[model samples]
Target chain A: EIARAAAALLRKVKGPVGPLAGRKVLITAGPTHEPIDPVRYIANRSSGKQGYAIAAAAAAAGAEVTLVSGPVSLADPDGVTVVRVESAREMLTAVEAALPADVAIMAAAVADWRMAEDAAQKIKKDGSGKPPTLQFAENPDILATLGHHAALRPRLLVGFAAETQNVLDNAASKLTRKNADWIVANDVSPATGIMGGDRNTVHLVSRDGVEDWPDLAKGEVATRLVERIAFALGARDA
Target chain B: EIARAAAALLRKVKGPVGPLAGRKVLITAGPTHEPIDPVRYIANRSSGKQGYAIAAAAAAAGAEVTLVSGPVSLADPDGVTVVRVESAREMLTAVEAALPADVAIMAAAVADWRMAEDAAQKIKKDGSGKPPTLQFAENPDILATLGHHAALRPRLLVGFAAETQNVLDNAASKLTRKNADWIVANDVSPATGIMGGDRNTVHLVSRDGVEDWPDLAKGEVATRLVERIAFALGARDA
Candidate 1:
């Protein structure tokens, strides 16, 4: 009916994803802020380029994409629903709200620890000899949570492993541990210029083996990933 | 005569300066990344908007401006020289190289500690029993270092205090402790929407006591602050 006509229109518009039309894609991106005070928070080197690129790519392929993003200075991608969040907990909540998707990509650099209890007031430095000790609590493991969930789990679950050394082994281990179908691994060494830079060299680790992806722009990476995803989903249906 | 003519041309182009013309201004902006490993670093909730705004404003006032910035998603301002760095140490070096200015503003949220010695490889968590312990080394205090330097010290030094409570008191304390001439204090409580937000409510604390400033956009604050600086310098030179 109306939905099928709209899907057909989208399929006509996006030739690359004629099969991907009407599919729902969920993505998470950026660095989660762990509030220390109202003013200060702990964050990392996540510019949201990769996740934004993925969201854009999925949308271009005619997927209904919902992007749950942490605080980032990036423009929202066209045709994608964006939910802005501040912390790991909030990001998890947003992800849950955007669930029941066909595919899920967890690419955000989530902080492992946050202040157990955020100080309502900014912590003052006493001219005292010792600095204040910060106590941390473990953040929710978003990938593992969704992967292990009984219901509301996406058909295809993907995670990211931003590693420095032993990249392949670490990524392989994470693929099993997180129960993720695929783990996109990359080295974020300062020398690599991948942390906040546009270029990335990643490997896709799956149950079969690792596929070493060539160095490319983040946007190109997203495009290739989406094409692979479309092919796999089409094969599954066939 | 040639130098004076060039100065006159620049002043004609940027008409805001009453006394900032021909003056050298140095500014530091953004959050310093303290490396934990090749993949991770500690950072704060700093967008560098305020510091960048100050640099742009100073340049608009016909000042020879040098902005030393850490990792931030911002384009370099026209008519301002920008030195980019990743960590606090690098920022300090860049700031030192751009020194001997008429005015210096420290707006970088520098991490207090970095990994004592960064692991060459990413630290892996054993599924065993416990998380790996992290050791940290204190970072150099760039504000105090510059403020105390005999030869490289600027004529007018300013520091900022992003406080949640006792804003004026903390700012005053920081002014004396850091040897800065003025302290710009702000409440960054979540209620204020100031941290990583565009609008700011700041208090200018000087030897003459506190001047409560109204909430305004970061760019507006920069403009007014530059005006005040121009006035002060004009009076001193006169």
Candidate 2:
């Protein structure tokens, strides 16, 4: 335990060598599993690849990063603190707790709805073939919550819009609705192979305009996004 | 292609050594993903560990094994013909295709219901606070289908009953309702940690009576089950 503390202290005291050296970056990633019962759940197809890559890039660039992740088969990125959560509500709570950041990226594909009332026991099929009617409850929107925070809101908030149709228009609207500085939008239609695939083709939507980006590896997209963030921050300071 | 064919021929010609050498066993394992949309799905907590273990054990006993599996991260077991599938309907189709076996085990946690009509586009959240009303359609009962198959019904049919309450009673009812010879029943309450855990404590519910099993590793359970299967088959032949 002592040695572990010393290692953490060393990391805290490491030299300020990168553009984001003093920045605290908070990121959310993966698909939240909303319980319908003790055995079954509702889930999305986000693989957490892009968000994990971004976290790794931020850490490499000397940022103090906190990643609020949902259920995913992924290892924690090096030099970043990761808080694992299961449901959208839990992810929101974790994201709120890691507040007062320089930048916050809401990259997780959060479930839009959860069971109105999760059953304690597994629901069995009655002899009759009639199916159950599932009543859904809207899940807490993590990005909007952070955007509307009275205080401790990140200076530059980013949100992701994964859409099956009208990707750019949906992303542009999301930027205004969520009060985010930028909305990284992508076509996640099944045919695109983007939901769980490593390669991503994203468009940057902001107040200025939309910039269409070519297809690239998730890691490359992270690197490019980080560079743009640094430039944007430097311009604002100037 | 020639090398592969030669390898297959060699396996086919290998001396009949183990007790199950001349037998053919059919198994189904894992959780079916019932799609709600292109991005979201309904899933269960089954990790497919127990069923995969049984497949491996059966193959080791020299049975010609065919395993129909749902979405799982496990690698295919050595010498087993694995058929991968996604939804409950698809799984039923695959199981029907690989029929006429000496023994059949239905271990998959198939979805009880799926969307009545899957959305072609990603469902958008309207301004209203009210969530969508999901209409479910009952999925096919793979175990019951096999049990009622007139011509291709296996000599020994095994089903699994994963219950959070009334473990024994549920198993017994399932045996009668599904026309299964045995039901490997287990309590999968979150507290039990058996759904995704490496260990299991299962009860064998048969016509004779319920046999309580001690907590054992999944692999050990598979081994013992295979031994019982061999003995039962031998006794029947005698």
Which candidate leads the pack in DockQ?
A: 2
Across A1-238, the per-residue lDDT of candidate 1 in tens digits comes to: 9997886686677543454677999999998988877556677778899999999999988888999998888999998999999889999999999889999999998877777788877665555634566676678889999999898888899999998788899899999988999999998877899988999999999999999999999999999999999988888788
Cα distance off (Å), candidate 2, residue A41: 0.3
Error at B57, model 1, angstroms:
2.9
Candidate 1: count of backbone clashes, pairs at least 3 residues apart or interchain = 0
Residue pairs with backbone atoms closer than 3 Å in model 2 (clashes): none
Q: What is the lDDT of residue B89 in candidate 1?
A: 87
Q: Lowest-lDDT window of 10 residues in candidate 1 chain A?
A: A122-131
Q: Pick the candidate with the highest TM-score.
A: 2
* Per-model root-mean-square deviation over C-alphas: 4.4, 4.4
lDDT of 1 by residue, B1-238 (tens): 9987887786678653545778999998888887766665667778899999999999988788999998888899888999999888898899889888999999887766666787787666666434466665667788889889988888899888887677888888889888999988888767887767899889999999999999899999999999999888888888
For each candidate, the alpha-carbon lDDT, in order, equals 0.85, 0.92
**TM-scores of the candidates in the order shown:** 0.86, 0.95
Position B123, candidate 2: lDDT? 89
